[model samples]
Target chain A: MGDKTVLYDAHMKLNAKMAPFAGFEMPIQYTSIKEEVIAVRENVGVFDVSHMGEFFAEGPEAIKFIDNMMTNDFMGADLYKAVYSPLCRENGTVIDDFIAYKIGTERVLICVNASNIDKDYSWFESHVTEFDCQLSNHSSNYSLLAIQGPRSEEVLKQIEIYPTGDFPYYSAKEIQAHGEKLIIARTGYTGEDGFELFCSNQFITTLWDKLLNAGVIPCGLAARDVLRLEVGYPLYGHEIHDDVTPLDSALKWTVKFSKNNFIGKEALENYTPKYRLVKLSLDKGIPREGYPILNEEHETIGKVCSGTMSIISGKGIALCHVEKAKFPKDKKLFIQIRKNIVPANYHTKPFITGGHK
Target chain B: MSNVPENLFYTVDHEWIKIDGDIATIGITDFAQKALGDIVFVELPDVGESYSVNDTFGVVESIKSVSDLLIPVAGEVLERNDDLEDTPELCNESPFDNAWMLKIKMTNAEDKSSLLDATKYTAHCEASH
Candidate 1:
């Protein structure tokens, strides 16, 4: 058995299939993966992401510490604005990817992957020696619920204190709901207009119950994986890893070379990526992680990192890291599906776009 | 509760076989389908292929993972369920009826004796979970 979240009882009440993920007992599906995924894509769905870690950095040197630790520069970022970035090692290899929110002038809240909570906290502690800041890991003090989909605004409007229409993407605000303090951020892994609510464990349960009673769909990790993959979002262990750098993961846009001396800046400046991440659509068989991607000559060129049968596109889609020079210019590629070699086509990312506002 | 008809023969790997004379129709049990989540693709074995007992005959691809379909008994493939190639969700929607995977002519009719009945299979499923 793994650690159970505050919403464990709620999931059990819904008869959700519980599975161990990132050291937590998480719901893999409530009814079915297909139904849950469609609910997020077409209507609205809610996910329990309380297992994710939260760390707060505050003091006079908070911004300096964050700017030096992450690849994305937050020099002029407004208060309550969330910035997505990759935390890198000295060698430019990603330790983790996270969203850093500027809640105040001297305070920042970092939301990290569940599995990297301890490691990320330790990394921050080690790097804070040069700066005068206090870092606190408040992972256990909070529970997060993500309401995502085309109809997410309509669902959130029922409980949110502020007008849902005014919240911009990558923005966050502290608000009160049902007399409880909650932090609402217009950010999500799924390619949908959504808000992630962060609050105390007690308030989270109440919010979850309220959403459930309002006829909002309760989704699980299975649907979340499919939805993120459909939008070409990179997952931690799959697309980015301890040994994979931002350049290799198609996240070069997040790396601000103009920033004065950040961690991994020197290594990243000299390094060149050998493999490039590309989106693929299979003509027949469904591609899976670790499946060998072959070139036209049947030579192995790369391997799939994430894949799924897209519920919206009605085709097999995959994200693969292929040899930069060997990538087919004609968009033709082949993937080894069991015994047979299936034909595929390479296309630009966000395979199904225009969903997020 | 998973439906396990008393008339069907079961394998430890969660496959069900219904015998019609010397021919046996095989499909995954409702327990197996529910465990695999959503079935997205089914790769069927070619007709006329002969396989020994426990040989891998096909593959079932679900939204979460891929599972190999093993032959429960030694038999020669007589027919494949071509319908599943287009609509694989039938495996999840109706694992026993419309999603029947293969019909095989049994090589050894005596193999049926080793298969479990519905009650024993249900107990096995309960124990594993």
Candidate 2:
């Protein structure tokens, strides 16, 4: 068995169907994916995301070091505003995508995907020696809980320790919840109005029980995929990797060239994207990762990075990479779905939710 | 949650078959639906499609993965659930009532003895878990 999460016993106690993912035994679904998807869309749901990576960086140079590593203009934003940034290679290829929250000049917390934790840590260690920042990987000691959907705010309000905030998307605040400190960020990967709480593992189980008592449903990775696909969020391993740049991942707006010189600035400025990522809605069948895309002339152009049946849209959708010059957002492509070929329409979709956070 | 019909014959692969005279109605069990999670797409076989026992039929696509709905008995397809074309989640909500795949006329109905009953099937799932 791989490393287990702090909530492993809770999952087993609830008879959750465990599946191996990202080198961890995670709950694929507790009740059902459809029910969980509907709950998150219509009501409220909570997820155990302790498998993700979290790090705390502090020092006088933490601001300079952290700001230099990202490609967004977070330094100029409001105090509680969160910024999505792409960590990059020296040659402009994106290493990973993450959210960087600035607590103070000497303190910042970075949340990253689990698969890229080691690689990202090594990347930081290489250049951090010159920045005078103290970086610590606190992934093992912490557990993350995402409370999402239309009723999330109401549920959070019931907890006396949770501070009431009307912060807009990409905003966060440090608060005390249930007699414990938490960093509640109004951010999520599922394109929903939700709060991602970073708290200690010691209290995560108790927090989970409290949420369950509040009638919030427990959702798993199955519904999370559909929600993200409906909003056209690009997953790391599917639509991005070491070779893919943020520019190719359709996140060019997140890159700021005007910022001070950073590790990958030179390569990003000189390089142009070869394939542009596009959102596709499948009419024929369920699109999947690694599924090949056929051009108008039946030529192999790109591959699907992530795909699912959009619960909100009621259609099969996928995020794909296609040749930049030849890519047409309005064009149609034939996706090889099993033994048959089905048609798909392409467009540029935003990553936003319907409910207010 | 243990509601497998005692009269119906079940398969190791989580398929349920009901024998009535010479005809049989086949479908994936409730346990199968719980395991498959949300069923978003269903690929049904044609009415004229014929297959032997263990022959690969069509596919059932969930949000996370796609798996084939294998045929458990040798027979010809009599009908396909047309409702699943637009409402695939019926498999998860009501697997026993509305999620039946097809009705086939069994070639040898007595061969059903190899399958399990409700008591045996429940024990099988409990041990596996």
Candidate 3:
């Protein structure tokens, strides 16, 4: 039995197939991965993502503290705006990638991956000596729910809590629902236009019930994985990890090299990527993580990082890191699937794109 | 509850088999298909292929993970399901009928003695769950 979220009982009542993820007992699926995925793509779906970690950095030097610690520059970000960044070690390897929302001049809220909560908190705590800021781990104090898809706005309207003012993309707003304080963010992981709600644990069950009653399909982690992969999003454990740098993981855009002296600035400036992450489309077999990526000569050049069959495209798509020097020339790649080597075509764009409305 | 037809024999690995004379038809049970979520790809053995009991003959790839299709009886494959190559989702929609993966001529008819009836198979699924 792992750590159960506040929505654990709600998931059980919905007949969710519970599985362990990042040391938390979470829902893997309710009815089926395909069904849930389609519902989110064509209609609306809700996901209980309360296992994600949340932390607060508050004080006078909060902006400076965040800008220096992450690879991205957060000092110039506007209030209520979110910035995506990869937290790197001194050696330029990624610790984790997270989103930082500038809630106020003296306060910034950071949302991080659940698996890296402990390490990230310690890393932040160890660096606050020079800054006049306080770092607090509020992971257990809040619950998160992501309402995603094309029809997400309709569901929010049905709940009667949709923000009235300018709630642009990647923006956060604090609102009240049913006399409870709730933080609503126009951000999501499924490459969909959606809102993520963060509220006290006591209020989450009610919010979940409201979303479900409003005809939002209950989705789980499996569907979320496929949805993100269809749009070429990187998962932490699959695409980026302690041994993989942002440059190698195709996340160099998140690293602002112009920033004055971040944690991995010097190392990242001199570092050359060993492997370059690229997308591939397969017509034969589904590619999986750690599958051998071969060249025309059948030589193992690299390995798949994140791969799945996109039900939307009806084909296999993958994000794999190939040796920078051994990258395919003719756009021909082969994924060694079980006993057969299946041919693939290299693609620069995502397999499917939608829900950005 | 999953559909477990009374006429078919079952294995502990969640495969359902139907025997007629010396020929045996094999497929994953409805319980197995439901557990696998959606079947995205299916790898079938070629006709005239031979296998022993419990041998991994093919593969079934779902949206979540891959599972090996195990042969329940020793036999030579007489026919293979060609429709699965184009539409693998039949495994989820009709696991017992159209999704029958292979038709093998049994080398030893006594293999049926080790299979379980529907009532016993239902008990096995309940206990495992």
Candidate 4:
């Protein structure tokens, strides 16, 4: 058995298929992954993302501490605007990728992957020797709900927590709902326009019930993974890992070299990437993780990191790390299914666009 | 509770078989389809292929995972369900009837004795979960 989230009973009541993910027994699907994916793309869906980790950093030196640890430029970032960045090792390889919200000038809230809470906290603590900052792990005290889709604003408007229309993308604010204080952020893993709500366990449960009563589809992690992959978003363990650097993961844009000094800056500046992440689509076979990707000569050149059949396009899509020199020039890629090699074509990412701003 | 039809014979691998003379129709049980979630693709064996008992003949792909289709009885594949190639959700929508995977001519009719009955299979499914 694994740790259960605050909404465990609610998921069980909905007959959700519970599975262990990142040390938490969370819901994988309530009805079906296909239906939930469709709901989020065409309509609206809600996900209990309470298992993710949250850390609060505050003090006079918080900004300096964050700038040293992160690769993104947060120097002139506005309050309530979240910045996506990667935490790297000394060798420029990724430790984890996260979103940081600058709630105040001297205070920031960092959302880490659920599985990396302990590791990330320890890393933060070890790096705070030079800076006078306080780090607090409030992961257990908060529950998150991601209300996502084209009609997400319609669902959020009914709650009246804040003026949903005024909140811009990648922004957050403190609001009150049901007489309870909550943090509402206009960000999500799904490519749909949505908000991620952070609040106390009791308040989260209440909000979940309210959203369900208002006709929001209750989605699970399976649909969430598919939705993110459809939009060419990277998951921590899948696309980026301890061995894969941000450069190889197509996240070089998140790394700003203009900063004076930061962790992994020297290594990243000197290192050259040999493998490039590419997207491939197949019409018949569904490619999966660890499947060997073959070049035009039928030689195994790389492996698939993440893959799925796009519910919107009905084509098998995968993200693979291939040798930079062999791709585009080779022009053709094939995924080796059990006995057959199915042909696939390299395509530009965000396979289906225009869903998110 | 998963739907386990009374007359069909079952395998420990969660495949169901219906016997008629020397012919046997085979497909994954409803319990298997539900466990696999929404089936998106089904790779069928060729109609003329011969397989021994317990041979992996094809595959069923779901959005989240893929499972191999194991043959329960020794037989020669007589016909394949080409319809499933286009609409694989038939396995989830109607596993017992419309999603029948293959029709086979049995090489050894006595192989049926090795399979489990509906009661035992239902108990097996419940126990495994």
Candidate 5:
């Protein structure tokens, strides 16, 4: 058993079937995963995402410090904007993936994977001596909620304090909900048009009730997994790891090579990756994580990172980590999925681009 | 009220077998389908394939996970379900009736005694949940 978030009791009250994830007990699904997924695609669905970790970097040198830590350009991007970037080791291997938000003067809010909170904090404290930024882990004091879907904006307007209703994707702003200031960001893991709320832990129940009363459906991790897979969003440990380089993980674009000296820059400069992440649609089997990937002739290539049945496509889909040499678009792979060798075709991900009229 | 015929034997793994004289018509329990949610694919063992008790006979692919439908008794597959190849959802829509996975030629009738009766199977499921 691990620590429970403030929303744990609320979820159990709603009859959410809880499962352990990142050491926290969270809801796997409140209802059928299909219905929850449909709710997000067509209407609005609220998710309790308190398990993700939040950290704050504030000081005179916070800007300069974070700019060197992450691969993506921070100061160059506009205010109220967020960028997905990988914090790398000096050898260019991604230590973790994170989202950086510029909230105010020399201050930035970073959301990291729940499992890496302590590790990331220690890393920052050890290596970040030159910069005057003070890093604080604020994960335990906050409750995270995601109101995601095409109609998320409409539902948001129902909340009295969110008057500046329109936020471009990847942007964030502060708003009040139930008299508590909340950090609202137009960012999501499901690749949908939505807002993520970082609010006080004590206010979760009121906020959840308010959203549900406003007709926003409540979803859980089951729908979250399927939704992320549909859009090919990578998970922290699933598709990448500390040993996985940005180029090898198909995240080369996330690494800004020309940026001033950062960890992992030297290793990345002369790095030659042998593998790349590729999306595959299995023609025969249900591809799953850890399933061995093979070339057409049954030669071992790589392994499946994530897989699921696509309700919208009526087909089996998967994201695989495969040797770049063997996973060209013209090549076919066999995913060994439990007593079956399902054929897979290398294809581009983001199977469904949301926010369409 | 849905067809859990009084005579059929049930396995905890959700497979049910109806013994017609000696041959057994095998399929998943209706309870299994509801729990699995949606069936997208079924990998039925080919006819003439023989298996021992607890052998992995085939696979049932659902919308979320793949389950290994095990063999309760040592037997040879007499016939495979052909309709499921085209309409996999039959397993979900009608697990007890239209979604029969295979017909098996029994190797030992005594092995059937180890399986649970309808009353016992339902009790087992209820307690597990």
Candidate 6:
């Protein structure tokens, strides 16, 4: 058995296929991954993302402390805006990728991957020696729900959860619903216009009921994974990990060089990438993790990190890491399935586009 | 509960077989399809391939993972389900009928004795659950 989120009973009632993920027994799918993915793309869907980790960083030096911890430029971030960054080690390898909401200069709410909660907290504690900031792990205190799609705004509007003014993309707002404080952010992993609501665990069931009553379909982690992959968004353990540097994972854009100093900036500046992450569209067969990539002569080149059949494109797609020098030049590659070498072509990522806000 | 036709035979790996003298039609059971969740692709073997019991015949891929299709009886493939090449989801939609993966001429007539009958297979599925 694994840890259960606040929506465990709700998922069971919905007859979801539950599976263990990141030490939590979470819902993998309700109906089907393809159906839930299409619902999120064409209509609207909600995900119980309460298993993710949340942290509160506060103090007079919180802003400076966060800027030093993350790769992105958090110093110039506007209030209520969320900045996506990878927390890296001093050796320039990634610790985890996270989204930090700059609620205020003295206070920031960070969302990190569920599997890295303990490690990330320890890393944060070890690095706060000189800063006058306090960090608290509030992962157990909150339950999160993401309502995503083109019609997400309408569903939230039915419940009167909208703010008074324009709520820009990648921004968060604190509002009151059902006599409880709710932080709704226009952010998601599906590459669709959506809002993520963070509420206290005690009130999450009630909020879930309200969303369901408003005709919102409940999606699961499986659908979210396919949606993110279709958008070419990277998952932590799959696309980037503790052994992978930002340069190797195609995350160089997140690193801000103009900053005086950060955890991985110095090492990143001096180091060259050893591997290149490439996207491939297969002619046939689904490319799965750890599947070997081969050249035209059947020489093993690299391995697939993430892959699935794109429901939109109707083709198998994958993100794989190849040695920088061994990157296929002819755009021709082969993914070695059990007994067959399936041919593929190098393709630009974000297999489907134009769905973001 | 999954559908189990009263006349067909079942294997421990959840494959069903319908025998017509020496010729046998093979397909995965409805229980297997439900467990796999949306079947996106079915890798069928060649029509002329010979296989023994427990040999991996092909693969059935869902969005979650891939499952090996285990051959239940020793036989030489007589015909393959060419329709599944264009629409693998037929396995999920109609596993017993339209998704029949292969028709094989049995090499060992006594292999059917090892398979469970409908009543026994139903009990086996219940016991596993």
What TM-score would each prediction reach against the true structure?
0.97, 0.90, 0.98, 0.97, 0.94, 0.98
Each prediction's whole-model lDDT (CA): 0.90, 0.81, 0.91, 0.89, 0.83, 0.91
lDDT of 2 by residue, B1-87 (tens): 646988888888888888778677888888887777778888888887888888888888877888887787778888888888888
Q: After superposition, how far is residue A123 of candidate 2 from its true place, in Å?
A: 1.2
Model 6 lDDT tens row, A1-357: 899998999999999999999999999999989989999999999999998999988999998999999989999888888989999999999999999888777988889999999999999989887899999999999999999998999999998887668888899877887688888899999999999998899999998999899989999998998898888888999989989898998888999999999998889999989888888888788999999999998999899999998877788889899888887678678999889999887867577883767
Question: What TM-score results for chain B in every one of the models?
Answer: 0.98, 0.92, 0.98, 0.98, 0.93, 0.97
**Residue A65 shift from truth in candidate 6, angstroms:** 0.8
Superior by TM-score: candidate 1 or candidate 2: 1
lDDT string, candidate 2, A1-357, tens digits: 778889999988887878888888988888878788889989999989889999877898887787788887766666677788889888888888888887566778899998888999888778788877899999999999998898887797786535565667777778876678888888887766788888899989888898888999998887888787777777788787888888898888888999877668888898889888878787768888888888777777887888887777777788988888776445867688767777787665543355644
Best of the candidates, lDDT:
3
Candidate 4 lDDT score at position A135: 88
In candidate 4, which residue ranges exceed 4 Å CA deviation? A163-165
TM-score of 1: 0.97
Measured against the native two-chain assembly using Cα atoms, what DockQ does each of the candidate structures obtain, in the order listed?
Answer: 0.86, 0.73, 0.89, 0.90, 0.48, 0.87
Q: Which runs of model 1 end up more than 4 angstroms from their true locations?
A: A163-165
Candidate 2 lands at a TM-score of 0.90
Cα error, candidate 4, residue A40 (Å): 1.0
Please give the distance, in angstroms, between residue A298's alpha carbon in candidate 2 and its true position after superposition: 3.1
lDDT of 1 by residue, A250-327 (tens): 999999999888899999999989788989998677999999999889999999999988877878999998988787
Better of 4 and 5 by DockQ: 4
For candidate 6, lDDT tens digit of each residue in B1-129? 999999899998899999999999999999999989998989999989999999999999999788899998899999999999889999999999999999999999999999999999999889877
- The residue-by-residue lDDT of candidate 4 on A147-259, one tens digit each, is 99988887888867654446788987777777898888889999888888989987877889889998999999999988888888888888899898899989999999999
Per-residue CA lDDT of model 3 for A72-178, tens digit only, reads 87987788888889999999999999988888899888999999999999999999889999999999999999999999988898888677888778888777778
**CA-RMSD of model 6:** 1.1
